[model samples]
Structure formats: C-alpha cells, structure tokens
Target: MEDDALILDLQPLPDGIDERLAAQLTFIAEADRLKTVLRASPLAAADRRENDAEHSWHLALMVVLLAEYADAPIDVGHAVKLVVVHDLVEVYAGDSPVYDPQAVLDQQAREEAAADRLFSLLPADQAREIRELWDEFEAGATPEARFGKGIDRLQPMLLNWLAGGGTWSMPGATEARVRAREAGVVAASAALGDAAGLMVDEGVRRGWIRTSEG
Candidate 1:
C-alpha cells in the first residue's frame, strides 16, 4: 500500500488550466494509481504478480489481435475501448482473485461504487461515456462485450500455463473450477475456447493443475 503522505501530498495542477482540460488531466493523474493495483495473475517469466494496468493493456492488445475470432461481427474500436477501461475501477476496489470465494461475495457492489467515484472525476459527458462502456463490459450483453469478457478470462489461464501453472498449483484449484471459470471463453469463440482447454489439459497432464480424484 502507498503511504498516506505520498497519496495525500499530490502536486497541484499548474495555473491557467481550462476547466475541461483540468478535469481531463485530473482524471489522467488519478488513473496513474491503477499501476499500483496488483492482480493475482503473475508475469509469465517471473514470480511477481501482474498489476492492473498491465493486465488492462494486455487485454486491449488481445482484442486488437483476436477481434476476428468473435462469434458475431463487432466494432473492434468499441471492443478495444471496453478492454482498456474495464478495470479502471480496480484502482479503488482493488483486484480480487477469482479463486477467492470470500472476496467475490460483494464484488459487483464494490466495483460499481469504485466506478462511480473514479469516473466522476472526469467531465460529465466523459464520465457518462466511460461508465456506459464499463457497464456494458460488465453486463456482457453485446457481441463486443462478450468477446471482451472472453479474453479477460482467457488471458490469466494462458499466463498460468506459460508460467508453468503459477496459480493452478495452489491448493483447491481443480479441473472443474478452471473449466467453470472459463466457460464464457468457449461461449464467445470456439477456437480460443479450444485453445484454452488444451492449455488446461496439458497443465493437468503435467501435474501443473491437480485433478479432483488426485
């Protein structure tokens, strides 16, 4: 956690800033803290966990590269925007691990409050636009949002595979839990879903993930 002194003693914005620009800059400065919000997923090549900013950036890139795999036609630009802004609320709510049953109990309420507080830092128009995107992504009601959700679930699985089962090796990580968590990936894109299944199967075969019977 950042010390209160460092967070409270922020430098003031320079003089003569236009109202709109000041709001925009203020939101941007607040976004900087997202980099400090660490997630449970670790780097593929290292022991350290990936931060929320890195996770969001990687999701945006995934949308760019895998947009073609979406089950239905989608606006790639909108999908990219969805991924980029999806986790901004984590700056306030903090990243909750998917495997942590207790942490997920009130996840929606916590994130919604964070979204309201963080996005409200921007101009009204900008805040509404961002909040809509965030909500859409959360709802997963549209083709683009479904695709975005697919990659969001898929990325950590891929990372755990590449990192030699970093999280999968933890106690209580069973094949059933992994499959249940990633069912959305399969629903959105069969190809990517197959790939994710292959990773999990390999993980189990190699003893990276434990089976229920084990």
Candidate 2:
C-alpha cells in the first residue's frame, strides 16, 4: 500500500530519490509493461485473455495459499519471490504459451536477453538478486523452486477449468497432453496436484477437454 511512491504512472517521485533508486524505479516502471503481455489462458470470465502481470500475481498468491500442501517443507517467501520474478522476462521477450508447439524455439535466448535488458535497469546487487531468483525458478531444482513451479503449472489449469476449458479446448491441448503437463506440479505437491488431476478428469467428462481417441 505504501509503495505508491515507486509506481511510475503516479505523479512526481519521492524527494531525494538517488541514482540507485532512480534506476530501480525505472525498472519497476518498465516491468509494468508486463501488463500488456497477454497469455493464452483467458480469465475465468472468458471475456478476455489474462496478461503476464495477472498471471505472476495470481501465481504468487497461489504459492502463498497452497504452501501448506507442498510435498516438502518450503520457504514461502522464497517461493513467492520466485513466482514474482520468474515471468518478468516476458515484458521484453513476450509471452509464448507452453502448449504452443513453436514456444520451444530459441525461447531461452529470447528470455535471457530480456532478463539482461530488464533486470539491468535495477542496481547491480538488486539485479543479481532478481536474476538469481528467476534462474532458480527456471531450474526447478530446489524444493522451493519446485513448489513454486507446481503452483505456476496449476494456476492456468484452474483458470481453464473455471473458464469452461479456456485453452483446454485448443487443438493441441488434448487430455493426455494436459495431464502430462500437469503431472510435474502434482509430483511437487500432493494436495494441489490431486485437485488438478480431478479437474482434468471433470474437464474430459464435460466435453470441455478432448482426448486423442476422440
């Protein structure tokens, strides 16, 4: 609530803001571009697609609320940081939905370049901190990172089910593919994973999600 001073769209910045703070402010302002990076997943309303900012915020919230269900003990704050920074690269690289077959092409190069450009807007130490968090999230090796990932995978699936199979109805988004994509998160958190599995099953029964057989 008190961080309004950091919001670039708002009038004049705080008095005595230093060069370091100025850079940080600039990065924050630029990161706001994420709001324009639309995702394949639509909102529960199905009226419009959600943006990267909405996805990141929702992903962080999901991690916080579902921390208790993680398969291993996790630092919730660490997980939140991971989710918040993970997608910031999309501001520059643009979003490529995972189910998109073309998404894999040069994604790492694009995102890495985006990260360098965006995070560099912040002071050195701060940039390193965020970049490290982003890398950890990408690695998905740490317990916290894995849990963060599980929630990331779960968020859109929940939205899809709520939006009457939003992206699940896409030609490439078959039941088998969706289930396999969701399985990674299920391995990370039993409770949330179980819920995801059930939702996929219901989606199939509702004819919202299709199978190869069909």
Candidate 3:
C-alpha cells in the first residue's frame, strides 16, 4: 500500500515532548482502535462478541494463572507479553475466524502489513522490538510462544463449551474438526488439554457439536 494511501491520526504533539515520547504516545492511542475489532468467538459469560482488546486482555490473565500447567517450562512474563500483542494486528486487518479457511488465507501477509503500519507509530527501535515480539508470537517457535499459542486456542474452546457450543455449534464444526483445531491446547499443557478433550466429548454427546462425517 502506498504511504499516501495510509490515513494517519495526526494531532499536535505536546510542547517539548521528545521524539521517542511523541511516537510512543501515538502508538498507544492507535492501540485503542483494537477495542473496536470484533472477533468470531463470543465472550464466555457475556451475550456479545469479544473484541481483540478483550481477547488479548483475557489471554494475558490466563497466561498468568495457567502458566504452571505448561508442557514445558516457560518464562511466564514473556508468554504474557506474547498473548497481549498477538492480536494487535487485528485492529487493522480484523479478526480471522479459524473455522473459515478463507479468513485465514493470506493471514500472514495481511498481519505483517498491519504490524508495520501500527508498530511503526513508535520510534524506530521500539518499532523493531514490538514487531519482533509480534513475529515471535506468530511463529510459535519458542517455548513461550508455543505456550502462549496453546492458551490462545484453549480460551475459545472453553468459550464454546461455556456458551452451550458457542461458535462450534455453527455449521462445519464437527467433532473431529474441532479436535484437530484444538490440538495446540493439548500441546501447551496436557492437563488443560485433557480437560478440554473431555468437554468436547460431552459437547458431541449432547449434540452441541457434530461428530465425524459419515
């Protein structure tokens, strides 16, 4: 996309503010946009869709409380950080529904562009740091990232169970399909995975989620 095509929020910087502070403040304000980006999953206890900001916040708290159950040792702090920024790009590119393959298509390219546009609101060094964190979360290569990824998947599955089959009750959400989608939850922590697996089984038994195709 062309630079001219990008509409920026240009407001007067506070007098005598340093370049770094100005840029950081701008990025902070821009992050507020995340509150408006709705996601596919509904809030577990609420009647409405969850936004990117709420999802990130939920994951951050989950990471702290559930860190102990991780398959391998992880830096809890780092894992929390990964979850917080993982969905920041959704502010620009919007949330992608995992069950909808079309939504996930070109996901990387779209998110990278959003990351560049959003993270660049910070100073150069901070931009690089924030972008690297976003990349690490996306890669899910490191222990922290993998654990974060696991928690990310677990949250939605739990929501579906809590919401009487929430998104999973929608078309195309078969038992086998959901299991495949949630493999990462188990990969992150066996205990949580086992618990979620049992819930999925119940969901299938209750006819809230479909079983394998005949």
**Candidate 1 lDDT, 1-214, residue by residue in tens:** 3532223237877789998998888888778889999888889867799999999999999999998888888899999999999999988888888877787889999999989888998999999999999999999999999999999999999899889887786665788888886798998898999999899888889988878834
TM-score between model 1 and native: 0.93
> How many clashes does each candidate structure show, in the order listed?
0, 0, 0
Error of 3 at 164 (Å): 0.2
**Where is model 1 poorest over a 10-residue stretch in terms of lDDT?**
1-10
Model 3 misplaced stretches (Cα beyond 4 Å): 1-11, 212-214
Ranking by lDDT: 1, 2, 3
Q: Give the local distance difference test score of model 3.
A: 0.84
TM agreement with the true structure for every prediction? 0.93, 0.90, 0.92
Model 3, range 33-150, lDDT digits (tens) per residue? 7998988898976799998898899899999999889989999998988999888988788888887778889888898889988888888998888888899998989989998999
Model 2, 1-214: lDDT tens digits are 2422334646656778898988888888888889989999999864999999999999988888899999999999999999999999988788987767788687999999988888887999999999999999999999999998888889999899889889887777888889997897787998888999999989989998887744
lDDT values of the candidates? Answer: 0.87, 0.87, 0.84
Which runs in model 2 stand beyond 4 Å of their true positions? 1-16
TM-score for candidate 2, residues paired by index: 0.90
Question: Which numbered prediction scores highest in TM-score against the true structure?
Answer: 1
lDDT of 3 at 122: 85
